[model samples]
Target chain A: MAGHFKQKSKAKQDIPTASLPDIIFMLLIFFMVTTVLRETTVQVRTILPKAEALTKIDQKRLVTYLWIGPKKLPDNAIGETGVQIDDALVEDLSSVRSIMYRKLVEQPKLIVSLRVDGTSEMGILMDVQQELREAGTLRVNFSTKRDVVL
Target chain B: MPVIKKKERVEPFIPTASMADIAFLLLIFFLVTTTIDVDTGIGMVLPPKLEEDVIPPPIKERNVLKILVNEQGQVLLEDLPSAVGLVRDQVKKHVLNNGVDPRYAEATDKALVSIKTARETPYDAYIQVLDEVWMAYFEMWDSEARQLGYANYRDYVAVVGQDNPIREKIKAAISIAEPDAA
Candidate 1:
């Protein structure tokens, strides 16, 4: 009996790691499904205005972002304020209509999200609005941070 | 001669011992790269562009509450200077006048909160103003729903969702005018 007990104590106790790969695969699948790779790299800096009574857009696929603010590089010869569509800078405001019209045609239920800087000139913002109106994408969302205290 | 013996080859197996490490690496990469920003904003439907400027129909003077945000970031209520903090209360009072005074909105249904922003006005100020107006309407609905036996605003909304007649009627009263080119 003493010899049997000594032999049992000498035997190595190994943790079961055979299912580790399977567990890892499950986690990988979960992350792949949930992770949304950022579609476009932001070329401009922006500080969204703060507000209350904000409504969130439920469907990510149905929204298009329009970033209007000073150029990310202030030292550039062109003025600081500029309109950026996706990753490219929009030089002419008039062209905004055609570009947005094409997007609207592509997705009829498209909701344009305006991510304008807090201190940006409203003239450019309004101009963008007029172009959106002409494009017939009348649904606009002025993206803002929630003012919790107020 | 003795029968020649054939050599049997052992099948090679791929090592998957580090599979968890690979998956963890990828998961950490995605975790670092992902930005879970939930988009929220004030939604507005703009009128279609016309070939010529069309003037809005005249609203009763009492029913209209004109809020102006100027280039200097100053807020004006009815062309008189006003602070941003008091806007919600002022709007609520006018909206809930309940036909008690001729100088205010004749009824909740008739109230119109018109917001006009200057071209140079800071975007922050403009959003703040709109937020206050929307808050006023929401507060009114909360109290009104409470009177109807609903516990609170959220409860009332849960009972009668956004598409109900009451919400539609109230939404019609809030209008945003074209921004002034100041």
Candidate 2:
């Protein structure tokens, strides 16, 4: 019995690391498949408002983002409200129609997600909406965080 | 040395000991950078641009439930001074009235909840009001789903899809009235 116990312990002492590579490779493949690299660095301060009526946009490819918020200044101070589409801040509001129209031409089923700051006034958002209407890309999403229940 | 040393045989084997180490390195890199946060928000389809000469189909006064948000974030439900919290119940009552009250909608399909906001109104306030209206519609759908022996509207939608008649029955007809040009 003592000899048998000794043999059992010896066999179990090495945790059998031969399959470690396979396991690790499996995990690596999973991470690689699921990885979505951050594309653009946002320049505005967009603190999205919290709400309950939230829907998940499963098809990430069909959605385009429109960031609206106060511009981040050099001295950590926020400047006037600005609208950003992908990389560049839209200098002229009228240009929004052309840019969105080009995007609509590319992806007909484009859903424009408005990531607006909570404190932003309705004026800028309305202007953006007008441009979107002109561009004929009418599907809009008001991006908001899930409101935590107490 | 006597008979050519019998031509010494050496077995060849590939080294796999470092394979796990390399995989672990890559795994750690991805683990550090992967962000699985999903994008969640309220989805709305904006009305298409109407032609200059085309006049929109006129909706009856009773069919529309107008909720206006002023610059002060104060809500005006049906042109009456009201709090934001009351919009949900008022919307539900208006939609489900079914011709019972002359001031409310004639039917569920005819009911249109229009949210009009002033240019100076905070975005959050508009969102709050919109959220309430959406919640009211969701609650109605939930009850409708329960009556159909389903768990909730989502479950029912999963089974029947978006184009089903039930969804068309209690369709959420919300209109975002454009603010006056500044």
Candidate 3:
């Protein structure tokens, strides 16, 4: 302290506080570089049927969506159980294999979640599931409408 | 000659933080480089395990009967059904005809419960159909007055004594799938 004061004769030098800022900057850079940014796209187009009893699924990072469209079911009524997807028509579930294979390659343990119209054909639904299983997507879930009182 | 007589002034002390900054930066860099694991989204309400959860009963894969529901909500057993009303009968017939000896998988105590149902089947209709199958199993057990032995199955039917009703037998159980879509 005496040495420092002895040289305080009308002269001053500034102490830098850049260390904390540098550390914070480095942390931001690290997260930006390593965090996994999942690319999510629905391989099949589907319109979710309206259910007063529908339940909202709560899953964020590890979810893969499979939509079951009403297309190809020749006997289906227009409004009976229509599902909506991005301005695209998904006529078949056979394409699920390729898409799932591509995604599963990235993460083998990924879980696939399906959202199908209530009135969709059981056959198609099962077919989709079978295809996923064949593609090694063993973890599966069905979204449902939890009856809510009017 | 006059300038040489003057003395020089020394600079005062000042603190520098260049090292601290570098250390902070390194710490942040490490914190960001770690990869995080994500959760799997599948959800299932599995049946609770018995006390002997890991008993590892049999190496045999039980025989399964498939019940399919087509787009029109028609129930198909082995690809055909005469009447929705007859579903239970058809299942019962299949279960009974499973050839009772070591030849028949189901009747020989190795039969699997009914097979899987498509996910898009009307939940109500599916539940109704499953209930009917269970009812059929009970009815078949009663009609034959059959009691299972501990050697083949753990279930021992209790004989009716005035107050106690005769316990019915259940065909061997099996698996149903959790469908991916509607």
Q: Which candidate is the best by DockQ?
A: 2
- What TM-score would candidate 1 get against the native? 0.85
lDDT of 2 at A60: 89
Error (Å) of candidate 2 at residue B39 is 0.8
**Position B131, candidate 1: lDDT:** 87
Docking class of 1: medium
Error (Å) of candidate 3 at residue B104 is: 13
- Recovered native contacts, candidate 3: 0.21
Clashing pairs in 2: none
Q: Which candidate has the top score in lDDT?
A: 2
What are the lDDT figures for the candidates, one per model? 0.82, 0.92, 0.51
What is the C-alpha lDDT profile of model 2 across B18-128, one tens digit per residue? 989999999999998887888999999998887989988988999999999999999999889999889999999999999999999999999999999998899999999
Q: Please give, as one word, the docking class of candidate 2.
A: medium
Q: What TM-score does each of the candidates earn?
A: 0.85, 0.91, 0.36
- Which window of 10 residues has the lowest lDDT sum in candidate 3 chain A? A47-56
User: What DockQ, on C-alphas, does every prediction get?
Assistant: 0.65, 0.75, 0.13
Error of 1 at B45 (Å): 1.7
Clashing pairs in 1: none
Stretches > 4 Å off in candidate 1: A1-15, A74-79, B1-14, B51-55, B180-182
